[model samples]
Target: MKDFLAELIEIPGGSGYEEQAAELIAKEFSRLCDQVHTDSFYNVYGIKRGSVSLESGERPKVMLAAHMDEIALMVKDIDEKGFLRFTSIGGVDQRILLAQEVTVHGREKLYGIVSTVPPHLQDAGEAQKVIKMKDMCIDVGLPPDRVKKLVRVGDLITFRSPLATMQGSMVNGKSIDDRASVVMLAEVMRELDRLQYAAEVYCVATVQEEVGTRGAVISTYKVQPDIGIAIDVTHGETPDAPKEDTYAMDKGIAICKGPNMHPGLTEKLIETAREYGIEYQISVAPGPTGTDARSMQISRSGVPTILLELPLRYMHTTVETLNLDHIKSGARLLALFIASLKEGWQEWLKY
Candidate 1:
């Protein structure tokens, strides 16, 4: 898992430009699935056939969705001094940009450093104000003519935070937001390979989740599965954050219960955890969640949907962090839940 995650995050797959990452995900999905396909939106789908047959001549379909897009930047302008100005693709905090290393995916991959006025160079009260993204520029150490020759106004810029293993079972790096969940799908598929299941599984790595739930909306409509599960990251406990708003990393996986989540499916998830001795924490949301789960729930006349989250810290930033062990725990729980589905799967959807 560590080696695969390390290689996955290094590929730059910002929203609206996910072709490269889609190719990699498709390759991985091909290894575990009976058939693999990539959509026009760059959404990758891998289908695993069910072993059991029903009297209706159709097996239940389960769709698992996790997005692969990360918050990124795009070149909006170029200054006379050869420096580049950028705009964010997703929910990027402009405050975190100063002095950060990034790669400009122009004609070629150009290494650059996000820079702004130095504190010492700022006027008396100027240092007290937050630096807007417009004020910051990327320095690629190239002359104006050279930069113009290789770079365009709309080139994508991705942060250069390589994955790093921390003490114990934690790892921190860029794009862990949903990429971690993407990897968890692989873990689920790997576990499923060793078990017998009755429902066909469609593992989908969606695109452009950060921009909106666009990919989820399209993919869910296409799959039209009987059940949908969206895997994503939620806020992890931080010293300054309120306890109620953030979850603990040590709690294993977060099984969300809310209006957007089908009550029966959520309960089934909990029941599976208890029966299998899986560690889990319950999260409640009064309204729709800001995840692909929301879109999946309402797609195509309505599909029963559930959300599973992995606790993460410093979300939407390059230094996002999570516990590695939780991935294994979540995978086991999902595999068991899928294996538990029987001939009367429709009955499980009742309130």
Candidate 2:
């Protein structure tokens, strides 16, 4: 799990440019799924057939979607001095952009560093404020002519941060927000290989979620499954974060409850967790969550949906942190729930 996640996080799959990550996930799923394919939009679908067919002469379709795209930068322009100006591709916090190493995916992969005015040259009161992203430039250590020759306008730029193992089972790296959940999909598939499930599972690695959940919108429509479980990341507890808003790391998966999530499915998930002694925390969302669940719920005639969140710190940054054990536990919970979906299980989705 650790090595797989490490390799996944290192791959650059920013929003609207998820082909590389999609290729890797499709390859991995090919071994686990009965049919694995990438759609036109780069959403990787891995289907596992079920043992039991329903009275309707069809097995229930369960869609498990996790976004593969991460927050990234796009080169909006290049100045005369080989400096690259950029705009955020997703929800990027400008405060973290200073002096970060990045990879410019232009004509060729070029290494660069996000650079700005040094403190020594800063005007009075300049050091007290965060540097705006527009003021920062990616210096590729090349002259103007070479930079223009290599990098063009509208090229993608991804953080070059590598995954680092922390004390115990904790690991921190880039793109852990949804990529970690992607790993959770793998774990669930692995566990299901040993269990007998009745629902045909669609493990979808969705694209362009960070931008606006566009991938979820299209993929859910395509799958049109009976149930949709959107796995994502939530705010993890930090020293200065509010206890009401953040969950503790290393505790368990956070199962969300609210209007966006189906009540019956949420109850079943909780009950399954209790029955299996799987540790889990409850999160209350009064309205729509900022996850694929929201989009999934409104797709087609409206599929019964739920959201499972892995606690993560420093979201939208390169060093998003999470507990690997939580992923394992979440996978077990999901697999057990899927296994419980026997004949006439559609009744469980009713309000």
Candidate 3:
């Protein structure tokens, strides 16, 4: 799982440009699922048929979703000096742009470093102010003519940070916010491959989640599943962050509860976790979760949805961090829940 996640994080799949990551995910799913396909929106779906026969004449369809897109940049302009000005593709915090290494996906892969005015060269007041993304530029070390020929406006850019394992099972890299969850879904698929399950599982790797849950919105409509579970990342505990606002990194997976999620599905997930001795944390989302769950909930006549989150630190930054154990535990919980689905699982949706 670590090696797979490492390879996934290294790929540049920023927002709408998720074909590469989607293809990789589809390849892995093909090995574990009975069927695999990619939609026009690049949302990859892998179906694992259920072994259990039901009198209802129809097996429940369960959607397991993890977004594949990450926060990135798009080249908005090329200056006369050959510097590239860009805009955020998602919810990017402008404060981390200075001096960061990034790869520009233009005519070809070009390496560059985010540039900012040196502190010594800036005025006293300017040094104290946070540098906005508009003021930041990428220096590709190419002349104006050459840069224009290689890089055009609207080219995607991603952080060039590679995944690094820490002392224990912790790993850090860009895009761990969602990629960690994607890896967890893959683990769930692997577990299901060996188990007899009642519901037809659709493991979906959704795209364009960072820009909005556009991929989930469309994919859910296409699959029209009975239940949807969105795997995502939440804030992890950090020394500087408030303890109440973050979850412990290596403790357990977070099962979210709130208006955006279905009450019955949330309860079933909690029960499944406890029955299987799977460690889990309770997270509260007062309104829409800003995840695929929100979109899935309102799809068609409405789909019952649940949101599971892995604790991650430094989200949307180049050094996003998470614990490997959390991924494993989350996958186990999801697999058990899916396996626990019965012939009359739809009856359990009653509020």
Candidate 4:
């Protein structure tokens, strides 16, 4: 898991540029499925056929989606000091911006650090102010002319934090927010390969989710599955965060209930988790979930969807964290839930 995640996190896939990770996931999925197809939008769809085909009695079609994009910085302007000023690709916290090291994508990778005025320069009272984007500048160890030669507008910048082990079971890294979700889908693929299922499964590694969930919106319309499951990260609050609003890290996965999710599917997911002896928690989101499920639920024909969340703390920041055991449980729970989708899932939904 760490090896696969290392390759994914090392790739510079900010919002719109998820092609590299998408291709890697597609290659793995194609090896396991009967037919693999990629749409015009570049959402990769791989299918594992059911025991009952279209010729036989109908079977529900299920689609499982995970996004490939990770939050990052895009080079907007490079100043004389060789510092890169940029905008964020997704929702990010300004609090974590100070003194963080980053990798700038060029023909050759350049290492830099987000820096600010030294403490010696700032008045002691003024130092209490929180760091903002404008106050931060990247310092690549190069002279102005050489920096200009290597870096340019639209170059990628990513947080340079490595996968960190917290406590015994908890892990922290750069893109665990969604790579954990991708890993969940990978586990599902492996499970289905090991066991027989009665429903057609279309598993996708969706692109552009951090930006607008454009990938799931486009791909779900194409696959038009009877049921959709969107996997992504949610809140895992630490001592500094709001306790009532978040779950504990390394405890369990979260089952979402909200307007964006189908309640019946959520109930079924909870049941499956319990039956499989996988620990899980309940999460409630009143409106748009900020997840791929929101995009898919409103797709053509209005597909029913549910969201399975891997609780991650400090999301969109340099040190996003989660538990590997929770992720593994999420994968098992999803596979068990999908495999239990009865032949009449579509018919059952008609009421």
Best by lDDT: 2
Worst 10 residues of 3 by lDDT: 341-350
Clashing pairs in 3: none
Q: Using TM-score as the measure, name the better of candidate 1 and candidate 4.
A: 1
Of candidates 3 and 2, the better by lDDT: 2
lDDT (tens digit, per residue) of candidate 4 on 1-351: 656776776676777777777788778777778888877666778788766444446788899998888888888899987878887888777778778888888667999988877888988787788878865788889998888999998988888877877887777878877988887777887777666577888888888888889888888988899898899999897888887779877668888888888877777788888887889888889998888999889898798899989888888877788888886778778878877866556644542
In order of appearance, the predictions have TM-scores of 0.97, 0.98, 0.98, 0.93
Model 2 residue 322 lDDT score? 90
Q: How accurate is candidate 4 locally (lDDT)?
A: 0.81
**236-291: candidate 2 lDDT, tens digit per residue:** 99999889989999789999999999999999999999999999999989999989
Full-model lDDT, candidate 3: 0.92
Which one wins by lDDT: 1 or 4?
Answer: 1
The per-model lDDT (C-alpha) reads 0.91, 0.93, 0.92, 0.81
